[model samples]
Target: MARAFIGLGSNLAQPAAQIQAALHAMTQLADTQLIAQSSLYGSKPMGPQDQPDYVNAVVALQTSLTPHQLLDALQRIELEHGRVRKAERWGPRTLDLDILLFDDLQFSDERLTIPHYGMRQREFVIYPLLEIAPQLVLPDGTPLSDLQHTCDVNGLIRLSAQ
Candidate 1:
């Protein structure tokens, strides 16, 4: 099984409810085990900053799915939660699920990339990931703490978890 980490966030209507629903939906996937989850963190949107701040969390999973298959699953969950690609980059989203890491796999294609390219730079991603797995190492041997300290994002506030 590939040990994968997924980033989850929602900023539209019923933000917290939407995040909970997405986590519940993920637990129902076949051959996937929800191993650990970080507490929800509220943060300002990364870009196009005129919208709502997002509630973000990370889930660690043990899954039999390959990278692309996992991406497909995440996309399906987003669609089920009323996610639309019509908005501008970093616009308010009902549900935003991103695959942050897929074990040691390094993949690049027309559609997706593993070890999510932007994760290390976003405290919204690094902070919660540190809470769950602070010692996790990248393929290039970079410790998560090393990455977290270097990230410039601030204002991450942990919220109540269900």
Candidate 2:
């Protein structure tokens, strides 16, 4: 089984609850085990300021599924939680599930990218990711703790211990 890290976020319809529910749904994924999860974090929206702040967290999973299969399952969970795709980039949503890292794999395609395209720049993603895996290093061998320091966490807040 390959170990994977998933980033979860929500800014609509009770953000914290949406993230919690998504965590629950993750446990039910076929051939996947929810190994660990970070605490909830509140952060300013990355796109438009008109939307509510997002609640974000990171989850570690051990799965027999391939990267594409895991991505498909994550998309399914987002759809189940009422996510809708629109033209607006980084817009508010009911759920957002991203494949942050999959083992030590580095991949990119029209559909998805491992290590997530903008993860290093977002404190919302980095902070929670650090909480779960403090010593994590990217596939390229860059330490996550070092990346955590490079991010600007001005508006990030930890909401819960779990």
Whole-model lDDT values for every prediction = 0.90, 0.94
Best by lDDT: 2
Give per-residue CA lDDT, model 2, range 48-148, as digits (tens). Answer: 89999899999999999999999999999999999999999989999999999999999999998887999999998898889989999899999999987
How far is 144's C-alpha from truth in model 1 (Å)?
A: 0.4
Clash count, one per candidate: 0, 1
Q: Give stretches of model 2 more than 4 Å off.
A: none
List of clashing residue pairs for candidate 2: 39-162
Location of the lowest summed lDDT over 10 successive residues in candidate 2: 146-155
Candidate 1 achieves a global lDDT of 0.90
